[model samples]
Target: MSMQLNRKYITIVFTVAIIAFPIIIGFFMLNKVVDPEEIMITKTEVSPELITIQGGFGDSISKYHGYNISHHDHSLFIQIKGSKFPIRGDKDFNISFTNTYGDIAEIYLVGQDNAKRKIWPQP
Candidate 1:
């Protein structure tokens, strides 16, 4: 009779562990799902024409200037007046431009990487 009770107790313990193991794993998986900081923006696209910039100069320049913008992974490609320029970023960039006589030009730059800010002053 003692042997039968010992076997029953062992079976009950084993069954409870089998059920509880998945529950414990699911609890950890739920934490992983709820974390938003783990999410990343794999790709981003911005149209130069669609962007809004403050100040009178930015508004006037955007209204008259034209640009072609493209981004792939960490690299940026910009084309204007049959010339292309490439830039790479470990984070993000805010780009703007101005055209003088449709020949002479300037590119404004604002960028951030790992929370460090940089601005390439208007030229």
Candidate 2:
């Protein structure tokens, strides 16, 4: 009978550990989800005929490949290029495009790892 009681205690502990393991791991993993090379928008300007965006990466410019911008359905997507052989030096971008994102509502800055952050219209 004591052996059965011990088994019950062991089963309970095992089940508790099984349920708690992912919660513990997920808590640790949440901290790592933020990218170290994420981009940050420092300034933005919107005019009647032009829209200007300026930002830079968290790391050195060499760590990145390049940048691109796309306008889609009232939103702007800034895509960061990933590089295997990166260039050396520091650089920031100031790009202007025709104010064509009619009724622009959102702007996204996409990292080299494909992670995205909304930069405009402060959320």
Candidate 3:
């Protein structure tokens, strides 16, 4: 009788752990910071007058607004505006800046969460 009780207890504990471990791990992973390279750039339009880049975070539950563009020498610093919310679906963005610098060798997309990624001249 004592052996049966101990076995039943152990089995119950193992079942609970199996069920709860994934839930705990998933919760932590959801809150983890997103890497910059994960930011996907889907489309880019480069012209002599304007530079337009369109992209979004797939499977991200964050709300993002317009971009803030700053040009320095041969690089363009583009930062997305907005914050993460308890929402669903992906967020897309359209950013355009004047092509006063002529030719851009590099482009960086900075997120509101401080994630920075290079989107142009992909290597």
Question: What's each prediction's clash count?
Answer: 0, 0, 0
Residue 15 Cα positional deviation in candidate 1, in Å, after optimal superposition: 0.3
Taking the tens digit of each residue's C-alpha lDDT, what string does model 1 give over 11-105?
Answer: 99999999999777754432221111211222222343333222211111111122244444433333211101122111222334432122222
Instruction: Indicate the TM-score of model 3.
Output: 0.56
* Model 3: per-residue Cα lDDT at residue 55: 78
What TM-score would each prediction reach against the true structure?
Answer: 0.30, 0.54, 0.56
Record all residue pairs in model 2 with backbone atoms less than 3 Å apart, i.e. clashing: none
List ranges where model 1 is wrong by over 4 Å.
33-38, 42-123
Candidate lDDT values, in order: 0.31, 0.64, 0.69
Q: Write model 3 residue lDDT over 1-123, tens digit each, in one string.
A: 999999999999999999999777655444444445555678877777999987777556654444567788888877654435444324776767779888888888765476677777775
> How should the candidates be ordered by TM-score, best one leading?
3, 2, 1
Candidates 2 and 3: which is better by TM-score?
3
The Cα error of candidate 2 at residue 49, in Å, is 1.2
Superposition TM-score, candidate 2 onto the true structure: 0.54
Q: How far is candidate 1 from the true structure (C-alpha RMSD, Å)?
A: 18.4
